[model samples]
Target: MDNTIFAQSIARIRSLETKMIDKAKIEAMVESRDFNDCLRFLQDTQYGSYITASNYEEGLKSATIDIYKEMYKICPLREVVDILALRYDSHNIKSLIKGKLAGIDTLYLTVDAGTIPVDRLNIMVKEENFRDMPKTLRYYVEKAFENYKNSQDPQDIDITIDKGIYEYMLEIAESSKMEYLLDIVKLMIDTINIKSFIRINIQERGRDFMQKVLLPKGNLDKDLFLNNITDSLESFANKIMHTDYFKWVKEGLGEYIKKGDLGSIEKYGDNYIIDYLKKAKLVSFGPDPIIAYILARENEIRAIRIILTGKRNDVSPDIIRERLRDVYV
Candidate 1:
C-alpha cells in the first residue's frame, strides 16, 4: 500500500476529529435528568440529526451507518476501513446463523456498515451459499453450521464465527503490512482471550471448551492458555502479570474478588485498547488517524448508548459512569 494515498484522507479525518464527542459532552449526557434530557443533550452535537428520529436505538444505528458510509467515501484505501468493519460482518453472520437455527428473523439485528451488505449476507445464509463470502468466512460459516447441527447449541455458532473473524483479521493485518494495524488486532485478540479465559474459569467449564473457543494469533500462545485453563483465577492472573495487561488484569481481579463483578475486566480491557489506539494521535498522516478516529467514534457511540439506556431504565448515573468505557478524544 502507498502511504501517500492516505494523506488527503488523514486531513479529512483531522477536521472530523474536532466534532467527536469529548469527555465533557459524555458527562453531560450521563448527568442528564432523564432519558428525554439525554436525548436533548444529543441534539446539540453531531448526532443531532439522527437523535431527532422517533427511536433512540434507530437513531444510534443510523449514526453508526452514516459514519461508516463517510469513512468509505473519504478513505483512499478501502482495506483499512474493511479491517475495522470486519467485526460487523462476523456479527451479522452470527446473528443470521442463530436466527436461522431458531426460526426467527434476525434482520433487525443486522447492521449495514459491514463490507458485505446485510441483505446479501442474509440471502447467502438463508440459501446456505458461501460462494460470495470470503473464503475464511465461508469456511467458518460452514463449520459453525456443522457444529451447531451436531451439538444443537447456539453458543457453538458464536465461538466458531468469532474465531473465524479474528483469523481473518490477522490475515488482513499481515497482508496490509501495517505494524500499527497488526498491533491493534493482536491487542484485541489478547483482550478477548483473557476475557474468555476468565469467564470460562468462573463458569467452571472444562479444557475441551477452552481448546475449542480460545482463539490463536494473540500475544499469548494457545499452549499458554491450555496449560493454565484449569488454574485458579488468582493463579491465572499472576501468570499473565508479566505481560502488558498486568495492570488491568490485577485491577479486574481485585474487583472480582471484592465485588464479584466480571465487568471490571471488560471495562479495563476496553479502556486499555482505547489508550493503545490513542497513540495514533501522534501520526500526522497515513491510515492511523483515520482508523483511530473510526474507533473513537464507535466508542463514543457506545458510551452514549450506555448513558441513554441507563437514563431510560432509571439506572443511577454513578453506575452508568462506572460502566462507561474511556472515550478516545
Candidate 2:
C-alpha cells in the first residue's frame, strides 16, 4: 500500500479526532449521578446523536458499526481496514460457533463491522463452507470445530479462533509491507502473551495449555514463557524487565502481589499498547494515524460503556474511575 494513499484518510481522521471523547468528558461521565445522566452526557458528544435513553446499548453498538462503516468508505486501503476489522470477524465466529454448539441464538451478539458481512459469516460457519473466506479464518473454523468435537469444550473454539485472528493479522501487516503496522501487531501479540502468561501461571496450568494458547509472531520468545512457567510472578517479571514491557510488568506484578487481581495486569498491558499506538499521532501522512484514530474511538466507546454500566448498577464512581483505562486522546 502506498503511504500517500492514506493522506486524505488521515486528514479526515484528524478532523474526526476532535469529536472523540476526551479525558475531561470521560471524567464527567464517570461522575454522572445516574444512568440517565450518563446518557445525557453522551448525547452531547459525537455519540450523542446515536444514543437514546431507551436503547443506549443498541445506540453504542450502532455508533461502533457506523465508525467502521465510515472507515471502510473513507479509507482507500481496504486491506488495512480489513486487518483491524478481522478481529470482529473472529469474535462473531466465536459467538456463532458457540451458539451452534449450545443450540442458542447468538445472531444478536454478532457485529457487522467485519470484512465479511455477519450473515455471510454465519452461513459459512453453518455450512462449513469457507471457500470465499480468508485462509486463516477458514482454518480456524475447521480446527475449532474438530477440537470441539473431541473435547466438547466451548473455550476450545475461542482459543483456536483468537490465535488464527492474530496470525492472520500479522500476515496482513507483513503483506502490507508497513513496518509501523507490523510493530503494532507484534506489540499486541506480545501483550496478549504476557497477559496469558500471568493468567495461566495463576491458574497453575501446565506447558500444554500454554503451548495451545500462546500465539506466534510476537516480539517475546515463546521459550522465555515456557521456561518461566513454573517460576514466581516476580521472577517472570524480572526476566522480562530488559524488554519494552518492563514498566508495565513491574506495575502489574505489584498489583498482583498486593491484591491478587490479574485485571491490573491486563489493564496495564492495554494502556501500554494504547500509549505505544499514540506515537502515530506524530506522523503526518501514513496509515498510522488512521489506525490510531480507530483504536482511540474504540477505547472511547469501551470507557463509555464501563461508565454507563457502572452508573446503571449504582457502582461507585471511584471504582469506575479505577477500572477505566487510559484514553487515547
Candidate 3:
C-alpha cells in the first residue's frame, strides 16, 4: 500500500498523458464535415496508424484493448488496474450472457481487456460452461443463467451480474487496503444503486424488486432506497439532501422531470467520476496517477466514439456536444 512504489509507474503515466486527446481535438472531431474527416483528424494523432474511416470502430476497440493491457502490465499496484479491468470483464460477461440467450452476436460490444481473457469468457458462455471462470463470477453467472431459464426475465441477467461485479470489486479494493481505490469503487456502487433506485421506482417495482437490484456496501443504505420506493422523485432527492450526491441527484431529477429519461443523471454520474480522477493531477507519486491516466484514456475513447457515432448518424453537433462528458485533461 506504499504509494511510493508507484513512482516509476507515475513517471511513465505522466509521459503517456501528454498524448491524450484534449478538448480542442475533441471539438475538431465534433465539427468535422463527415465521418472520414473525423477519422482523418484522429489519423493526425496517436490512432492515425490504423484507424481508417471504414474500420474506425474496430480499430478503436482493438486500440482500447491494447492500451489497457499495456497499462496493466506497467502498473506497480496491479490491484488498481485490476479494479478497472474487472469492470470491462463484468461488462463483457453481461454482453456475452445476453447475447447467448438472445441468439445474437454481442462480440463487437465486448471490451477484451480484463484479467480474464475475453475469448475464454466467450467460449465459456458459448458452451454454457463457467467452471473455469472466476469463482465469484461463476457463481453469479450460473445463478443468473438458471434464473433466466426459469423466469425468462432478462433483467435478472443484468442485475445479478452487476451486483457480482461490484461485490468482487469491493473485495479487491478492501483487500488491497487502498483508500483512494476503495472510495472510487464505493462511489461507483452508490451511483449505480441510485440509478437503480430511480429506475425501479419509475417502473413501479417494490422493495422486493429493489432488494433484488440494489447493490449493498455503498455510502447510501439499501434500506434508504427500499424505504423510499413510494416517495416522489422530488421527495427522494430531498431525502438524500445530506449525502454527497444531493446536488447532482437533484439536478438530474430536474432534467428527468423535463425529459422523461435518466440521461442527465447518467451524464452527471460519469462527470463526477472524471472530477474525482482529476484529483490525481496534483499527486507526485502513487497508483492514483496511473489509475487516472488509464481511466482518462477510457474516457477519451468514449468521447471519440460519441463524436464519430454522432457524425455517422447525422446527429446534430450541438446535441453531440451536450452528450459529451468533461475531458480528464
Candidate 4:
C-alpha cells in the first residue's frame, strides 16, 4: 500500500466528483423557475457546466475519454498505461484491417477508446511488431483480420472483433490480482451474458455458434445461464430472482413485459452494472486507489453526460434524474 499514490488518486477523484456535482447543481438551477438565476449560474461557472446540453449518447462517449485522460494523469502503473495504449492501438488496427477488407479508405476507421496518441497508434499499425502490441489487442487484431477474410458480411466481421475483445477482457479479469478490477470485468461479462442469453432463447438464432463468444468472469454460474438458454425471458428472470440483482433486472425488464423490447432490457442490464460498479468503488479503499479512482471518475463522468443529454433533449428534470446512475463520491 503506497499511501502516496493511494492518497493522491483518492484526492483527485474527490476533486473531479466535486466539480461534477457543481455542474449538476448548475444544471438543476437552470431547470428552476428563474431563467435569470440559470443565466447567473451559467455566467458565473463559465460554459463548462453546459455539457448538459450535448447529445446524450455522444456525451457519454466523450465523458469516457475525458475521464480516462484524468485517470492516466494519476495512474503511474505501467500495466494500466500499457492496457490503454494497446486498446487504442488495437482500435486503429481494427479500423485498418476492416477498412482494407471492406475496400474503404483507412480514414473511415477511427480510434475512440484509448488514451494513446492517434499518431502513435498509426505508427504501430505501420510497424512490423503489431503482434507485440498488448496481448489482448494482438488477439483482437488477428481475429478481426481472420474473421474479415472468412466472412462475407461486414456485420459478422464486426461481431467477431467485439466478441474477441470481450473474451480477452474476461481473461484479464480472471488472471488479475485486483479483486475490484475482477469484479468490474465480471460485471461487464454478466451484462453481455444476460443479453446473449435472452437473444439466444428468444430468437433461437446462432445456436452453439455465438454462444461461446460470451466472456464468463461474473459471479453468476455461466453454465447455469447457458443451460437455461431455452427458457422464456420471464422464466429466466424468475430463476435469478433470489439474487440481489433480481429486483433491478425485474424492474428494468418489466417495462417491456408486454411489448417485448429486448433492446431496452439489455440497456437496463448495462445501466445496472454501471451503477453497481460506482457503488463498488466507494467501498474499495486501500492500496487499490488507482483502480478505485479510475472507476469512480468514469462513473461520475457518465452521470454528468447523462444529465447533459437530458437537458439537451428538454426531457423533464425528474425523468432525467431518474435515469441518472450513481456517481462515486
Candidate maximizing TM-score? 2
Q: How well does candidate 3 score on lDDT at residue 97?
A: 90
- The 10-residue segment with the lowest total lDDT in model 2: 48-57
Candidates ranked by TM-score: 2, 1, 3, 4
lDDT of 1 by residue, 1-329 (tens): 56788888888888999998899988988988998888888877898888753587888888898989999999877878888899999899999998988899989998888989999999999999989888999999999999999999888999999999999989998998878788888889999989888888888897888898888988898877778888888888788778999888888888778878889889888888889889888887678888889889989888988998899899999999999999888
Cα lDDT for residue 90, candidate 2: 84
- Quote the lDDT for 130 in model 1: 89
Residue 3, model 3: lDDT of 74
Going through the candidates in the order shown, the clash numbers are 0, 1, 1, 1
- Give model 1's TM-score versus the native structure: 0.96
TM-score of each: 0.96, 0.97, 0.93, 0.73
Kindly report which residue stretches of model 4 are placed more than 4 angstroms away from their true locations once superposed. Answer: 1-5, 22-66, 80-96, 105-116, 123-129, 170-176, 209-212, 258-260, 280-284, 287-329
Per-residue lDDT tens digits of candidate 2, residues 278-300? 89888877788878888888888
Q: How does residue 32 of candidate 3 score in lDDT?
A: 89
| Global lDDT of each candidate | 0.88, 0.87, 0.86, 0.57
Alpha-carbon lDDT of model 1: 0.88
Candidate 4 overall lDDT versus native: 0.57
Model 2's TM-score against the true structure:
0.97
